[model samples]
Target: MFPDTPVTSAALSVATRFCSPALLNHCVRSYLWGVMYGGAHGIAFDDELFCVAALLHDIGLTDAFDSHRLPFEDAGGRLAWVFAVAAGWPQERAARAHEIIVLHMRDDVPAADDPEAHLLQVATSWEVVGRHAEEFPARARADVLTRYPRLGFGAEFLGCFEDQARRKPDSAAAASVRRNVAGKIAANPLETHQG
Candidate 1:
């Protein structure tokens, strides 16, 4: 279950309504991974903000929110900003949520700079390409996968990125495609491992 808060609940509602089943599962798993990673690293975070940001980081990938020219992260970050403000969050707190979503797409974020962003970036990469995946216990990994199966997320996610690349040639998605993200997605342990 997600952190209990109006913003967190709203995030879940919006994500479930906009994201595909596969994408939604990925979003949820991202949060679980971050939680486990934080616990393992003894990194404390604001649970409600972290949970809301994690669930909405990929919102721009959805048909309802995708921007034609902006990178998905920027678009998603903007939407999350609006959502946070609407949920009665202070501007500074809402900005942190926006920052977390945008920063998750980065290659790395220093924990000292922003723990939530650092944790999310690491967690998303862990889910997408198995980066630092071994740090997580098998039991917890299996539990999360059981709760939210990949549901063909690898194939679906590749398609999404491919489309994003085609539509926005100068995007992070394009960079990912150039790096052969498809290969990484295929080789991710979660894709082949049977929990």
Candidate 2:
């Protein structure tokens, strides 16, 4: 496992124990975007905790997704809650995190007061859109722009991906994701959501 560096070492270790490099890279990319959002917006947040939470937010998916469990569903939430509590996360945060992860697929869920939830949404959106862009065509790009407008971090997150794509065009994964992201940017140049 990577060094703790102000975050929970044990959590990081457990969260990443079975993930693939592509998944890990996806997590890093999302976390970096969260860091960028924090830096530019000057939000008062726990950087270390946010970073760790953003990185591990999907860790429970190893079991949850595999078992076809829906975290948003009652049974899924209970299963996820139990797993998170057993995994050593504080009860309060675990309950909240379980809800967010379970309902992450629901676009209508209201944003949580917890800043970590916002950061997690920003990070997860970028990771998913970026990772899947290669398989999707330009027509699908509009969905990302439309779906994440309320996220308030979409444009900045896209800019970051754009910069990375421009700097490293040879990156198969980055290039694939950036293709659609670039289209999203071109389609909506004036869009910048508020955090």
Q: For candidate 1, what is the TM-score?
A: 0.96
Instruction: Output the worst ten-in-a-row residue range by lDDT, candidate 2.
Output: 64-73
**Candidate that scores best on TM-score:** 1
Clashing pairs in 2: none
Runs of candidate 2 with Cα error greater than 4 angstroms are 1-7, 60-65, 71-89, 108-112, 130-195
Q: Give the TM-score of candidate 2.
A: 0.50
112-171: candidate 2 lDDT, tens digit per residue? 465655665655654444422333234433443443333433444455444444545543
Q: Write model 1 residue lDDT over 41-138, tens digit each, in one string.
A: 89989889999999999999899999998999989999999999999999999999888998887768887888999889988898887778777777
Clashes of each: 0, 0
* Whole-model lDDT per candidate: 0.89, 0.48
TM-score of each: 0.96, 0.50
